[model samples]
Target: MVMSLLLALPLAVGLWLVTGGRALAVVLARRITAATAGATLLLAVATVAFGAAVDRAWLPELGVRWSFGVDGISSPLVLLTAGIGVLVALHAWVEVPPGGSPATFLGCLLVVEAGALATFAARDAVLFLVAFEVVLVPMWVLVARYGDAHDPRARTGAAQRFVLYTAVGSTTLLVGILLLVATAGTADLRRLADQAGAGLGSGTQLAVALLLVLGLAVKVPVFPLHTWLPPAHTTAPTAGSVLLAAVLLKMGTYGLVRLPVSVVPDGFARLAPALAVAGAVGIVWGGLVCLVERDLKRLVAYSSVAHMGFVVLALASGSDTGLQAALYANIAHGVISALLFVVVGGLKQRWGSVDLAVRRPALRETSPRLGFVLLLGLAASLGLPGLAGFWGELLAVYSAWTPAGDRPRVVFVACAVVAAVGAALAAAYALRVAGLVWAGDRPDPEAPRTPDTTGVERWVIAVLAAAVVALGILPMLLLSTTADAVARIGGAR
Candidate 1:
């Protein structure tokens, strides 16, 4: 409980600084940011040390307790969020100029990190909802205030759309939770699981499942509900984009696994086919859009939709193998997407544009190092074997071929094949970006040439890139950790 509250302290401090007096705010802001970062880092370490420790009934009345813990299911994600928080802090140390109160941005980031960690660690539905929603306000401010000012409309519009889409999803999720509590007579997940099937009617169970999934789908931003993602990614500052892709979006899928599947297994099994269809559609649709996207950031953003679609497909398969694959894919997507966003953010910072065509010809000649890094990131994104992307794709397809008894194996197999096609499309777009930007003509006289990656940027990217390669080569490290949790969730042997 102390560790959790410490994790949340930075954000609280940040909020104070943000709302404080303008005259001395800048000085106070710097102090606040330093304090927050220090405290956050310590708490993050404590969380790892306390690994999987649960404290139930810390608050009995609200049914909200310090029922927090880490597992193979959540530990990796918690580490990812904390690790990224540190890196983003490092990045801000150099990038953010002096005038703007760094306190607010850092505070918001810490808050987002706290929320994300809490979401992953939460064992209770109400606690999860609180942690999940806590992320929204800070992130919205980050985009609307700290993002690119050159296009204020784009920034504000993207933030608004993001809020609207996610809010609707959250409302649905709240209703689903209420229904579950009302029908099942308790909100405790373990208790719900024990009592759900026997107590609730099939129709009621299915309805609750659908409602919860609908809420999660929007956060997963699957296909039609995904409109808010690209614009948000395109307009958000680099750190904001990193957090959004790497941690925030996973909240949806995490909820799906933690809530519905854990508490209402039969309901999820029944809905697997429709879920598979949605995943298939998102894979195809997002891939097609990426192939045509001219903006580098937006292309990467759309690619996330495609990548996450694979995760959804795996989950929808309702097999132990599929669940494991989805877990692998989820973590892989986080690392790869963070790499892509970092590369794109670097490009935008250097060249003043994310337009692939405008920045193309000069990339090889001027920014060779950054270009090479971008290529590596894109290769990982394309699911090249021995990179982080391959395991998930391979496992997802494999699971589709051998689905659980309850699933529609034929449909899942077809979706797997379409996903394969999407993979090929990914390769095409990745190669196109590489060729157009780093392999083609000499320097474009019209476009400005920029410096190669700086020491700090190179160090940050190298860490992320190395992570991608390591995960790709040693997927077993992740697989072993996640397998038990995935099996437990699926009620498999």
Candidate 2:
């Protein structure tokens, strides 16, 4: 019952929001989305609290099931998805994308939520893949349709890139899944996890792992394959950016860990060294790019490349500590990134543009709320200790320095050093962005004073701020939940 409600309820709400008589109405859409998302949030909380895995066979003949469950690793992400769904719905209620009916925008948002919920809950390989694909369309719609209207063509182009890149990843992912099923003789993730690569040969495992990773990597946007992310984030609506950063990106990293690293141990071991190196490059590249970027949202988008690099490093490290850090970092990035986008979006909403040079003084003096939230986001994002963001990077680097699996020490250590440098660059850019927004004289003193955050916006910022601090102060809250599961998956060093 709980598993069913967690996925079905939000999807049902999305359906009604898109098709009901009042589907076109903003207030109705908000009411319905809020009510349903709120319920889903509770269900997610319950799932985490129980920490039980549930599997109900749905396609017995095809070796699939309507399996849905949460462990220490997945529970936190499921919770993050649900909480953000409510926040996104609430935030959208007031800040509907320009030139669209409130119903359509909010409805698509709900659908994204439903897809994300299902993705996080999936326990079988086939189910995970299906839920994974479910999220693409609505997200594409958000990017292509309700994107930055000023550059319609750019938005359309970004949407195309997103679709093309992700589509290729999906094709590769399907092949990987089929390969795993053929080699392992089942698509059941639980069974595979138990097998621990016993039945598959090293060659078969490597081939399957490469294909699966190729699919998930494009989604994770690992370095060379990450070109699609910035443009998509830049063009997407605020809700789209939030969801993309917060939940959608996690799907890729999560899948990589849950699928390849967990099920194909020998294959993952083969890829670990190179994977760590790629992650290192992404970390450095993302940070360096952020330093030069002038567009606030795009800078944040690139920062994701750097940040998720930590998660990638952690997974490649293949130690309990590294996996734990990756999980922690994944959730922390989701919260911090969403907060950054909200503040950036708010700035754009008011200033008509987020050209840091043009909208310098308005944010801090005109609206201290934005200023304050921006500062918090910057501090948390720069891997400040006692904040949620610190643990993931710190542990990932440590794990890399002293990797658990039998990978090359030189490679992991070199990558670890590079990631640490990336962390410093991250600080440089985070502070730099905050300084641009909060410091300096008014570039446009007479450009009309933009209004500050509203009551709802203030509340939203406060809640997210509290979450960042809470996780930072009590990092164990997440670490405790994920430690056992990650240890179980990789056997901590």
Candidate 3:
């Protein structure tokens, strides 16, 4: 029943949002969806603490099941998705697109949440894949429908690129899943693990892992395959960017950690050197791009490509330290990126641009709290020691120093050194953004004085800010919960 509610409620809210449009007022629709999101958040949080799961057969003859559950590995992500869903819905209420269809916008949001939650909770590989594809549709709609109104053609083009890239990734992922299922003889994640990864040979594990990594890499937007991200971020609306960086990006990393790395340990080790090289490239590439970026949102967007590289590098290490670091980094990136997009989005909406030379934000003079919050996020993003970002980068670097294998010593160490260089580059761009947006001298008299952060923005930022600090101050809060599950997956026990 709990599992039923978790998946069904948000899906129902989405269906209601779309179908109830003509019958229900816009305000009513928004309220309903928002309430649903809030309730879902509560359920997700409860799951994290109480530890609940559901497994029921869906296709008895073929051995499939409508299985959905959460362990330490998945619970935090579920909570993150639910919490972000609530905030995004509320944000939509305040910044509905030009078409003025709040119901449609909010409804698609609920659908995305439903899909994300289902993906996090799914216990069967087939169910995981199904939930995974479900998230793509609503997100594409958000990108297409509420894209930047000023330039319709660019928006359409960006949306098309997003569809093209993700579709290819999804198709590749399906092929991998089919192969694993064929060999394993079941779609149950639990069964596969207990059966020692389908009892396959090292060669089979290597082949399956390659297919899975190639498929998920597109979504992770790993280096060479990452062209789709900048354009999507450049054109999508604020809510779109927030969710893309915050929730959507995690899907790929989560899939990478859970499926390719965990299910095929020997294969992951075989590919670890290549993965480390690719991750190092992404980190340096993304940071270098951010250094030259002119637009604030796009700068943050590029930073995601770099930050996500840390996650990849950590996973490639295949140690508990590395796994913990990757998970922590994943959650940190989500919150930090969301905070950035919100503030940067507000900057764009108010001043008509986030470009530094075009118009000074003058946030220091006009809105101290907004300026300070932006500063805080910048500090956190650059991996200031007491913030959420610091711990992940620190440990990922450490993981590379003493990675699991002795043979890959040279490769892992080189990646670590490159990641350090990338961090320094991250600091350069972060300070650069902070200086331009918040620390400039008072602007010209003609510049618009954007109002200070609203109650809504303040509360949202406050909650996220608190999370960043809390996670930083008490790393054990997450580590205690996750260590056991991670150990189980990595065969550390």
Order by lDDT, highest first:
2, 3, 1
lDDT of 2 by residue, 1-493 (tens): 7778888888877766666734356777678778888898998887777754577778888888888888777888899999999899889755888746677677788888888878887888999999999888888889998999888999999999999999999999999998898778888887888787887888998998899888999988788899999999999999899999999999999998888888888898889888999999999999999998988889999999999999999889878888888889999999999999998898888767777656445467778877888888988888999988898899999999999648889999999999999999999998788777776444567667657888778777888899999999999888987877877886521
In Å, residue 266's CA in model 1 sits off its true spot by: 1.1
Candidate 1 on 373-475: residue-level lDDT in tens? 8888899989999999999988987887778887877898888888888888889888888887777543467765678887767878888999999999999
If scored against the real structure, what TM-score would every candidate get?
0.93, 0.97, 0.97
Q: Number of clashing residue pairs in every model?
A: 0, 2, 0
Deviation in angstroms for 422 in model 3?
0.3
Find the number of clashing residue pairs for candidate 3: 0
Q: RMSD of each candidate?
A: 2.4, 1.6, 1.5
**Could you tell me the C-alpha RMSD of candidate 3 in Å?**
1.5
Q: Residue 446 in model 1: shift from native, Å?
A: 5.5
Model 1 worst lDDT run, 10 consecutive residues: 92-101
Clashing pairs in 1: none
TM-score of 3: 0.97
In terms of lDDT, model 3 sits at: 0.84
